[model samples]
Target: MSWWHWLWESEWHGILLGRWMVAVLLLVMGLGLAGLLASLLSRFFYLSLGKTQEDITRRELHRLMRPAWLFAILLAVLYSTLHVLEFFHLSTRWVDWIHRLFQALVLLALGLLGSRLLAVAETILASRYQQANEPYKLQLVHPLFTLGRILLFVLMGFLVLETTLKVNVGPFFTTLGLGGLAVALAAQETLQHFFGALAIFADKPFQLGETIRLENGTVGTIEKIGLRSTQIRTLDGLLLIIPNKRLADSPLENLTRTPRRRVLFRIGLLYNTPETTLQALKSELEESLGQLPFTIEKPLICLTNFQDSALELTVVTFVDPFYRAGNSSTPLSFLEIQDQIAERILRTVRRHQPQTDFAFPTRTLYIQKSSTGLDALSEVSRSGK
Candidate 1:
């Protein structure tokens, strides 16, 4: 035989080592082929993204595609190596065991790849909806994916038990079914909380870091929202934990949604003040308030009522919900703005004091006696003298 033919036909002195080297060479070749195929597939995939190029972000592409390519390469290399080993002279039992081990490894890799792909899909969809301003579009994504992952692992376990360990999976599946039922029964309350969280996500009643006031006057900032419960940081700096069910069912006002705060108050003045002066005072208040920070809207100042003792000037104004004070990035509350307005009102009123006297409850008394009674009193006094 020729030299090349002899090399191909001859098992070297170390037959096992030669077979191992041959398997390794086949594995390397399979890896290269798999890599090339993966690159083509990825290229085609990106090309297919005609209009929806941004559908999968670069980060997501890396997260999903990298794992997929690696999985493919691993499968190809392992499969090629195992198949090559079958061509060699080996004990039947050993070959069978090796095949079973390979099968188990394949099952694990497949399951992991499936789980990761599902996660990538969910993440892409979630981000797409969130970007489109449909915050609730994929509200059920988390719970569903979590459920999917559990099912995948169970299935992988069943496969491994049946194919790798040569065990009966029938009884295990039956047991799983009954156990699942029992678990459902025991976790009823937990399920309720989970569904409640789903509803909250769907409705978007409040968001993290937002201030909300509940029906029962519970005011707090949303710290965290979880499947079982939501945590709130109360105004008093206490952490409040509320079950998701309760929070989703209760009515809550999103304080952060208000663009501005409206304050209405009445300032009473003496009825004796002139009408022109009243008009001037109202105009003055409008001008003064307009000068304050975040007082962009013209204030409403009108004569609202004529009381028993005074004329009431009612003023309604809107102040921006939050304001940065004196070069500080921290926002001062609207309450402080209300206080500042009160000061301005007082100063404006004081400018016209005495003339614009603040009205108070007052009474005037007059004493009178009849002329005949006075004359009779005078006669009695003269007789007594």
Candidate 2:
């Protein structure tokens, strides 16, 4: 016999040369058809949606389409393989296990495809959300997206285990229920922070990039908000990590939310300064503050208190809130505005009265000698004479 005839006639396991060739051809053809169909669908979407080749939607669709094509091809191949085995009378116990293993693989592929689709959906939603101007919504997007991805993975795992592996999850869930208390106790702090993060999303007490003051006297700009903690960059250039639970529970102050900042100035003048000068000083201060670019309105300048050493004049004004950008036409810090106003007040005072002195702590002492002591001194002086 010829070598080819011998090879064709030989059956190493269950399939002969003819059957193996047919199965290979079937698999190849199925995969090729799947690829063609995917391409056609892609072209259809690209044309109908007015999307370019490089558009994100087109790219994501291309990425998602390949796995689906592969999954379909794989299913067809498995079915074909089973049918071939049955026709050849080669269906055995091991073949059944092989079929089950193939089914499991198919299920795994499907799960992966589902995850990809979910990820794509999440990306779209996040993009939409980020385009919105709402600060609270922006803050909630990341945490919610992360949570959705986690849940998607969990569901994928459960579906794979139950449908493909035929594993019973009843006992597993029972064990989890029995150990729920222990698990909760062990993860108490983690749970607290997790729930606290949720509360922060719901309540929106503060947002990223906003200046906040904590009850513990930590003043900083919010850098990041996480499920377990929040990161803040303080004025001192130090990064502060605070637990979400504590941050949410504490008395938090959102300084960025204020429309304007109130600046209080206490100016002390010499006690002996004239009342007319003080009034002039007050008027000058009010006019100067009103002209400042940072000032929101005319200042409230008045004599507020009579100190033991001097008279105190309080100057109150409203200015744009500090450290926030784009809220005002001019970009200036709170300290800078304060310094400019103070310098102007000093210049005005000096111009009005060059010799006017600022108040300092002073005491006037009067010594009154007793009458008897003075008469004795006079007698002593006369005796000496």
Candidate 3:
């Protein structure tokens, strides 16, 4: 006879306060049971997954269990929430709020879990890829993992805003345009650096541990490549941080790419030396360099120039590129190598040919002197005569 009685009698009676309370209690009890079941299922899944030819340990088993267990818990929470909501028919005023709350919570949890999982995955991949020794494939591991995680977080954030909060996505996006533009402007340099890093990764520019020279003449070995800047170890034992944008735009010279470095120089062989000795000099130079382990097989000898006092022999040889391994040997920078080779050639030449002189720039000078006293004496003698 009453409105409450009529409402209770209708098909929508499940949404009443009493029915909702009952549903809540059921949800709680069901979630607890599900949690226990999930724990058991997780252990089973982990054990099954790890069952390979290799031996498995308890610690390894626990490590394997964490991901599946986390995923199962997430699913259980989502399932219980939806079922409870449906039973109470919260398809009305409170539906959006309840859905959003669950969705936001799930997304937050997923973000946390995904980050940890991504990190673990990266570590494993890096170790395996390094051991695999496939240079091209190994390079891609970090980029792929990083991009995947970034996309996941971005998508999660958007879902939380639109689906979870029940916001009109179109209008919200339109409003965000101005804010996004401002952020872009503020971070333009950073964005450039990020893209620059991506370019470096994509184009296979100088990789980590390779020695490179920037256009501005900053030469160093690349220690780390990051989103905005690169860390470099200078020849002088200092660490240099260079912005990625500059690196991307600048001319980069990768010294370590080539197995051997080409060395070119002109050495003077004194013209005063005999024809037979000059012929022998060439053979001697080639033979001596050929004996050195670092020198390349072909020793390039070019008759470059003939000055008044010297016949310049262009000495060109290739040397195996070497990096400083430790403190024992002299750290071989390119300049240092150049100086060493020049010095070695001079020393070797001097040892072989003591009579052969190294040429220097030739110069000639003339001077005239006049005596004022002699001129005056001549004039007085003429006057007396």
lDDT of candidate 3 at residue 360, scale 0 to 100: 64
Q: Please, what is the TM-score per model? A: 0.72, 0.79, 0.63
> What range of 10 consecutive residues in model 1 has the weakest lDDT sum?
376-385
Encode model 3's per-residue lDDT on 90-174: one tens digit a residue: 5566776765677787786687577655655665566566777644345667777889889888878888888776666777678
Superposition error at 309 for model 1 (Å): 12
What Cα-based lDDT does every candidate model obtain? 0.78, 0.73, 0.68
Highest lDDT model number:
1
Per-model clash counts, in order, read 0, 0, 0
lDDT ranking, best first: 1, 2, 3
TM-score of 3: 0.63
**Candidate 1 lDDT by residue in tens digits, 1-385:** 9876666666654355546677888777777677666666666766666655566765455557666677867776776776755535578888888788888888888888788767767877777877876645555567678889889988998899999998998887799899999999999999999899888887788877788988899889888888889999987899999999999988888988888778777987887787778888999999998889878599999999877667888988888766788898767765677889999989998888666857765544334566766522222111010
Model 2, C-alpha of 297: deviation from truth (Å):
0.9
The TM-score measured for candidate 1 stands at 0.72
Question: TM-score of model 2 relative to the true fold?
Answer: 0.79
